[model samples]
Target: MQSNIKPVAYYLPQYHPIPENDYWWGKGFTEWTNVTKAKPLFKGHYQPRYPADLGYYDLRVPEVREEQATMAKENGVYGFCYYHYWFGDGKQLLEKPFNEVVESGKPDFPFMLCWANQTWKGVWFGDFQNQVLAKQEYPGIDDYTNHFSSLLPAFKDNRYIKIDGKPVFQVYQPLDLPDSKVFARVFNDLAKDNGFPGIYLLACNVPIYWEPEPNGFHGVISYLFHSFRFREKNTVFKEGSFLGKVEWKWNNFLEGKAIERRKKPKVYKYEKVVTKISKWPKMNFDYYPMVVPDWDNSPRAGNSSMILHGSTPDKWKIHFHNAVNYINNTSPADKFIFIKSWNEWAEGNYLEPDQRWGTAYLKAMKSCL
Candidate 1:
């Protein structure tokens, strides 16, 4: 392992599933079913396959993980950061692969969890897309303490990565988190209580929207802007009737207004957004961001949602190279580089080997990592 070089880590959620429509998207919603009782959220798409199938299909299946491990070893890549989701109230989501790695033998790579404590509503399996049934709200410092008390043991695992002699832990939606200070304090207290000395609590602030104000807790925050949709549209949805298209002339008027609004520049201001977040003394980098190939959740659109059209592998490669160059030239060598995901099929931003592109994205990652 290249200890001196900052590792390139992936956010690998073990429960990321290929939806067979096991949840709310099917006949479960039709009026014909008066006798039907309970149903899965994505009832139209996929079934709940074994958790092992998730890792097998997405990562370990078809020899992808083996291939990745071989490639990482060849490339001097340090580790893969599995997004460990521990339901603090005694529920473990997708602990199989990690357990297997530990039981069989030590893994070739080091790993750790981001403490995806935000909530559990089953989006992990592609069943619940934007249909968040519940949220594990910030349960205050006490809950975090209880949560970390268990998590500390996992941190002690030899596979966990450490920064400055401290284990690295990530939080997926820190912005959604109600209190940032209390969160930081809880993490610190937990680390001290565990006698781990220090903890690197990295917040996965993808868009840099909830940029923190410059404070001592800046070290706890890490800027990793995840670009799910970087594709530009010829038209903007400027002031359309909120109730999807109405009468013909009314729709034309809405279309004309939208066209007229096009005079404004569509270029995203990354520097400004990063600047806003960086002002808080947070660990801001010129993010070599990842872009989703596409994001058309219309499969779940029986409930009515906009379709994300137009995403090609070639265009995705452009974003991938941009990320690589940004990391190679822009980001600090000593700082960690992150990818949006190894698997996030629902939103369409995935690095996993998919049927559409095969290992094209993985090849792209090789050039980058």
Candidate 2:
């Protein structure tokens, strides 16, 4: 019998309720001045009253929360892998919905953290478009250490599943803070100090290519290859050592230059991250890769630096099936298939049903698994 482990959805709980205005910004305090000042691109996009000003950021609304839970629970979704954003300081935003999910006494499925350590500015919380709070300053190790210390209780909870007995920690921007070596040491040591054996640190290797160190730290290495090129046909990868040496050939960007002023590299280059990862023999690893509907964050970045617009729910299923096939064929039955998100509005790659095709994406996810 096929293992009961249905595919897992990585939910990046933006928790931005549907905004009244057609504009993308959710309701909250927005710093239009700073946003417009950041770059010329924000001229028309950055408005004084953004989506945040409309109260869409409030996930506490009954209708909003119900929609989220119901949508996630719909169509045989195994569970949600919440992208837990930590400020690495005392202040943490958006913990409310997650807290409610856990403490609401509702039947919540398994969830884990992706530790979005990227700098958060008003653009997100409507604080400042151009300027973000510089939290990860020099001696960044100390900042994250303190943040982890605060999150110890949540880290140890049973809901927080582990890979090979070590708690899984996903880093949105691994290179933002200290160098890779320091990050590796701090993560392992801190995790062990917190009574856990070690941490399975997963990083986003989208723009930055990652190769496991010859003597790399123990953890899971994941690559967020969200593009149509990777999805195209005849992309054959000779299965082998991706560490420091893996190659690929494809057109990374689907859209043209004038549309978004984002230049698409003629030769879309990338290491078959998973292919390389599969070659590792001694290390314990899990593929926490992502499936994207499309890559159009034009709502945020006016000029589409990276665009992939032709991805439909049906098209996305190919990646879904690819992940499932990979896991079933390669890893054991219990392996987790990490998705981009259940709801990432800015980027068009959300599983949540939208006005364009209500429930089409979620249904695709359901029927596939």
Candidate 3:
């Protein structure tokens, strides 16, 4: 294992069927429904990327989790940061896989939870608003405590990823989190009470300029997807300032008028987005750099998808190399480099072996490690 450089990949837990999805989508529906139906919109676009070794296994199967952990560990991935969904209070979606991992203790792989605190919409079936499936609601102090209480089992698990004896808890939409400081304080207090030093709170989907500590977060992991990476089309520069040293982050997406209002998929070369985005103006001490293996959400968004024209294993090697170096130079506490995902088949951004490239992407990352 690389002690100084930890590569943690985001793991999506939407593979197995859930009652919520069955009702919202269709009977016996999972992410595979979207993946198998994706059709190429352009000539060279890769569509219907099929899994090689893992097949379309259900997450409810313990053997599948074991195999995923084995693959991840063999390729130098330090841990799997599962996308944990908490609609508020003790309500959650996609909790089965990780819950089993915690209770069964079979894989024995390191992991952490990232609260996907967002409402479930009908976007899956193409209806954005009218069909409200699961709306996020933050009740009050009691609910917050119960939320922490529910996670106590996973937090106490020996396999839970931690820093300085503190379990790392991530919030996917920290910007949407009401009273982040309070949330941090409450979670930290709860952790201390549970024999932990404190909870290492990390925030995601925030601007590059966003500071973590001030906002009660230990650090930030900006999901620099090629689609939303603040650059040329929306970037602004100070008069006579250095070229790469100027412009904004995704705050424009959050603050300014919406940009994803396109009728067609927005496509860009992977080389361009990775090359330009990796040229950091300056190393951010409070920020952990992220690398994306590939991206194409057409499987989910149809024509409105944001697609990266070409992303091969060869390109991933260079991108991964840059991110490893970037993380290596950061403070030891911030030495973690995040991969966009281990498996998000619907989004076309996953490191898991696919028929298109097999384990080539993982092999490329192995070279870096």
Candidate 4:
């Protein structure tokens, strides 16, 4: 399992302040603002989690990124999948840290980019979804060409992670992409012209059961450890489904409540969800699987976010152990175990050491690998 598996962590660049974030969420608000402001919504809930090893450090400091790279590299983490935002026409957000990394060549860590092409909304700051923050758009070939040209430097860097001599570029919402096949072709042509094999287009978490072979993507990263599980259109909540649904019903009976609060919080136990989420259920197409250390986004979403209650290093270790075996015996060649995050403090989902769990999660991961 260790021989075949490569762990790539999802890295968030929101630790530093951007003009948009500063303007929208106050003068100096960063992801840590949300982290330090969270309150416990239920009994035995952990909130306001603080950093231990890394401290409340800012990403602008190069030493902070070096420390992160050292921690992840030593713990068998393969690369950083930094979320790259392009809100059409070359407009990007939260690119400072990564730009500095590429230019300075300090940590020398392997990295790739995932185009987080979703529209930002006020819902990110506990406001209604009607509030538009930034809209994602694709204005055809010229915009796509410009987008590819901007990242040519990073793509050409020695630290870029690749597959079959192709630099890996992820599409966050392949379904949302207009003329995705054409988009892939353009990137492929651009990569080839720049003296490379091609672009490895990896679609992350596409809806409508996206198939890679048909959709011009080299592969798909399965977010098997989703924070909130939803269904297709016209799908109804049936009895005896996810454990959370049953528990909610039972709790309603005991409390004489209807379990119908608008935007009511949905919580699922990490242990129960583990058993259900571990296996891939066998499919014709192969995929790289994801492992979440823990998740509780109430910090970011208040009472409306999904919480994975009772998450522990032991449980994550167990699930990861199963995932390794599952991938080796079944899935594709690379056998990538894409951890949902390297550091996303606001969502309470990260592998970085916090005040509680101090390097225990890292230890668990190393033990498995």
**Which pairs of residues clash in candidate 4, taking residues 3 or more apart in a chain or in different chains?**
none
Please give the ranking of all candidate structures by lDDT, highest first, separated by commas: 4, 3, 2, 1
Q: What tens-digit string does per-residue lDDT give for candidate 3 at 1-369?
A: 567788999999888999988887898899888999999998999997899999997999999999999999999998999998878767888899988999998798889888888766565444444356898888867777899999999999988989899999999887677788888888999999999999998888765556778778887775455325435466565423454233443433342123235578779899888886676434344677778888888888787677878899999999999988877766647478888889998889998888878899999999888
TM-score of each: 0.59, 0.66, 0.91, 0.90
- Error (Å) of candidate 1 at residue 354 is 3.2
lDDT score at residue 359, model 3, on the 0-100 scale: 92
Which candidate gets the maximum TM-score versus the true structure? 3
lDDT of 1 at 179: 75
Candidate 3 clash pair list: none
Candidate 3 ranges beyond 4 A from true positions:
128-130, 226-232, 235-261, 280-285, 332-334
Q: Write the per-residue lDDT of candidate 1 for residues 1-369, one digit (tens) a residue.
A: 324444454644433232222243343232111112212233232211111222334433435555655655554445676766655455555555555555544545677676666554333222433345434655566777877776766677776777666787777656556676777777777787777776766655433333333311333333423221221132233213432222323433343233333322222233333332222222363222333333333222222222233445555555545544444554432445554544444333455455445666556545544
Clashes per candidate (backbone, < 3 Å): 17, 14, 0, 0
What C-alpha RMSD separates each model from the true structure?
Answer: 10.9, 8.4, 3.6, 5.8
Query: Which ten-residue region of model 3 has the weakest summed lDDT?
Result: 251-260
lDDT scores for all predictions? 0.46, 0.51, 0.80, 0.81
